[model samples]
Target: MITNMRKPTFIVKQSLKIFCLLTGFAVMTWSFSFTKYIRGQFVNLNVLPERLKEYMYFMGRRLNGAYLSSLNKADNHDIPIIFIITPTYYRLVQKAELTRMANTLRLVKQLHWIIVEDFEVINLKTQEFFQSTGVSFTYFAQSKRSETNNHHRGADQRNAALDWIMVNHNPSMPAVIYFADDDNAYSLEIFQQMRYTKKLSMWPVGLSGGRTYETPILKDGKVIKFLAWKAEKRKFPIDMAGFALNANVLWTYKPMRFSTDADPGMLETKLLERCCTWAEIEPLADNCTKILVWHTRTEKPKVRMFDNVLEV
Candidate 1:
């Protein structure tokens, strides 16, 4: 009697185990089918959020337009239009410097000179120099000085020139814009090599005190980093005179003038932060291989005046 009962119990336990396994398999199949069905419905209905669709559409259109425009412009017509901005104050030493720069630019025809003076009126000598050059030039002077700073009103002076460019010329027309100091020496070859600039072109500058050279970090014919004491930590670090920018970039960023409030060594950082990125920077002058410009400063000459005699 006990043996017969044990066999029935064993049969019942085995049947229960089989039922649970079958039920689990059926549940898993149903879950999988439901998931597939939902995915299929989403795909067929194209049920993406409206905002996402709009964003993607806008991006696609913008990219297409940029691509077509770039393709049209890339005809190997390396005729780069260069605009030079020079901020001048108390033009005694700058006369020779300006002459040197003007002479160098004679070889480069597509050049526009924008000279900003830190005064309400342009000096007679500066006026005469520009008149003699017969080059395309514009002169601007700041009306007043509100701050007592070494780089007093420098930001305002630069902004005045930039504003003039935007108003007078097509913002996207020029190929390169350079911020040059009145005292620095520029090489003619610098202008020639800058024609290859897609965005920004940089090279080594010869500074004072036998410091030898200054330039950006190059890796595989590209600037991966900036090798300057001023810009080691910043995304890119080079002197204001070390690089040339595309006019389109200037229009795009539209920096709000240079600031005296900024800490020392912050001018480049602030200006660059607004307009440039590391990838856009192309380093030339590799180990002074293509050094065309030198960071030269003019020394102020002394003049003695005799009584009852006027010095011109």
Candidate 2:
């Protein structure tokens, strides 16, 4: 009887030891995963204080003149410089849209407009437009072909601007980049919102994504979901006009490119998915309350050719 009691007691003690060991192992595994996730985010460029500080210095500068000052700030430079990448193809409407966009952009201070053309040389109108308008701009011509079909557009023109930025800029340059289609309509207030982006920020875009508006659903200052019901089946289902990534993210993730392998309308999604996820995205434009941009495409201008010559 004494031996039997001792055996059962020993067995119970061994089982308890095994359970404690397994529990400790599970806890360690969970802790390691959690630490890795937090470390991954903190390690990214946007989280580094030095990078944001470098760019913030420019926006915090004050200047005289009603046009120079942001409505909210006495100092016009107290915002991130908006680096506008416009990929334009020659068209009669191109001049009109460029002029309109320039007019709107001039109202915003600390902005750089980079216009890249699809052809091997800059368009004459593009050169003339910036000169007369007095907008801060850099003009470049893409060395490769642009769109060969309707399915392919803005890839080459956009890449040229990205390449320029990568070569000329370092990770510390303080700026927010936006791909502004020539036809879009934007509010000056939008630049201010984009300037403060910590990582990647998204807002509502009008007349895009086969819907009236495609926007993020914000919950307690974070993006919980996107509102474009039509794009529910797609990954990162948002319009190109819907989001802007911090230039720091670009400098850090220098390999980002628009690829032919990407499915139609996912150019923005694929490019961004690798950089940040929906949870990392910060929703803007009044916490998803306002529409600061519109995809306002102008009617294609009518052109005529007579006697085997093109007519404008």
- lDDT for each residue of candidate 1 in 11-53, tens digit (9 for 90 to 100): 9999999999999999999788645433333232234454443
Model 1 residue-pair collision total? 0
Q: How many clashes (backbone N, Cα, C below 3 Å) per candidate?
A: 0, 6
Q: Tell me how candidate 2 scores on lDDT.
A: 0.70
| Full-model lDDT for every candidate | 0.64, 0.70
Which pairs of residues clash in candidate 2, taking residues 3 or more apart in a chain or in different chains? Answer: 55-174, 59-77, 59-78, 59-79, 60-77, 60-78
Per-candidate TM equals 0.67, 0.69
Question: Which candidate leads in TM-score?
Answer: 2
Model 2 residue 202 CA deviation (Å) reads 0.6
- lDDT of candidate 2 at residue 64, scale 0 to 100: 20
Worst 10 residues of 1 by lDDT: 62-71
